[model samples]
Target: MKHLSDNEKDTSRIAAALAEDLQPGNVLLLHGTLGMGKTVFARALIRALTGRPDIDVPSPTFTLVQTYDGLICPIYHYDLYRIEHPEEIFELGWDDALADGITIVEWPDRLGSYKPRLSLDITLSNADNDPNKREILIETNA
Candidate 1:
């Protein structure tokens, strides 16, 4: 499915709607350029999943992974942009997280040959008419 968002709030709403369809052990692979609002959408989805508007979802750029505890199921947010090798992901406990709960990964291309089947793929692109506008495409493999 395709979705267009006019602003951050719209993006969050779209993410929240998508969040309702997610289940435990699901993998969400997000692909987009820098500043394309991938992390923004992720934070919104995390909030929606936990039903906590005040929860702060930090970008896992440096930490590689961040875990959120208040949700019904554990949420593992991973940012592989800084990873130099796929082996580094194994060190970060990738397989264990996948076996746990929901996993939202950004820059999954960094995984190289280690591609896991994903429940959904979300790709974001810049809108031609507006800088703040984002064109998002969401597809479910299942």
Candidate 2:
């Protein structure tokens, strides 16, 4: 599905809607360049799943991964941008997250061969050069 978000609020709404369909063992691959609102969507989705609209969902840039206890299951948010190699993901509990939790990965391209074959791919981009507008595309390969 394709969506045009006129502002951050719209983006968050879209993420919240998507969050309702998520389940354990589900992987979400977030694709976008710097400042493309990947983190914004992620934060909103995490909040929706946790039933904490005001929760602090920090980007896992430095830490590599952040875990949250969702309403239905665990949520694992990963930022692989700084990883030296995809093999390093194993040390971050990638397998465990995929086995029992919902995983949201930013910079999933860094996963290389470790990237899951089945996942929901969400791509975000600037819309018409508008800083507040975003073009989002969601695709599933399940």
Candidate 3:
């Protein structure tokens, strides 16, 4: 699937749609460069899943992982950008999240060989030289 986000609100809308369809054990790999709207999409998604517009979904960049409960299933949002090795995933409760919730990963390249075999990967990039407009491509392995 392909989408164009003309503005931040459009990003939230796309995130809402995806969040609604996500289920336990589902993994979403988000790929984008810095300032390319990955966190914006993720924060909106977490809020939609919890049915709370004010949910404090902070970027897990430094902490590496952040989780939110109280939804149909939990959501584990991970920022593997800081990880120096794939084994760090295990230390972050990777196995538990895989079994019980949705995992949304940022900078998933760090996962190396441990990346999920089946996942929905989303790529966001600046479109038409417009910083606010994002071209998004979605690929799925079902």
- Which candidate number maximizes TM-score? 2
Ten residues in sequence with the least summed lDDT for candidate 1 = 67-76
TM-score-based ranking: 2, 3, 1
Report every candidate's CA lDDT.
Answer: 0.88, 0.96, 0.92
Query: What are the per-residue Cα lDDT tens digits for candidate 2 across 1-142?
Result: 9999999999999999999999999999999999899899999999999999999999899999999999998999999999999999999989899999999999999999989999999999989888899999999999
Error of 3 at 93 (Å): 0.9
TM-score versus the correct structure, for each prediction: 0.95, 0.98, 0.97
Residue 53: error of model 1 in Å? 0.9
Query: Over the full model, what C-alpha lDDT does candidate 3 score relative to the true structure?
Result: 0.92
Best by lDDT: 2
Error of 2 at 37 (Å): 0.6
Q: Estimate the overall C-alpha local distance difference test score of candidate 2.
A: 0.96
Output the better candidate (1/3) by TM-score.
Answer: 3
Clashes of each: 0, 0, 0
For residue 84, what is the lDDT in candidate 2?
94
Model 1 per-residue lDDT tens digits across residues 27-136 = 89899999999999999989988889889899998999988863668888899999999889888878877887888999989988886866689999998779999999
- Candidate 3 clash figure, as a count: 0
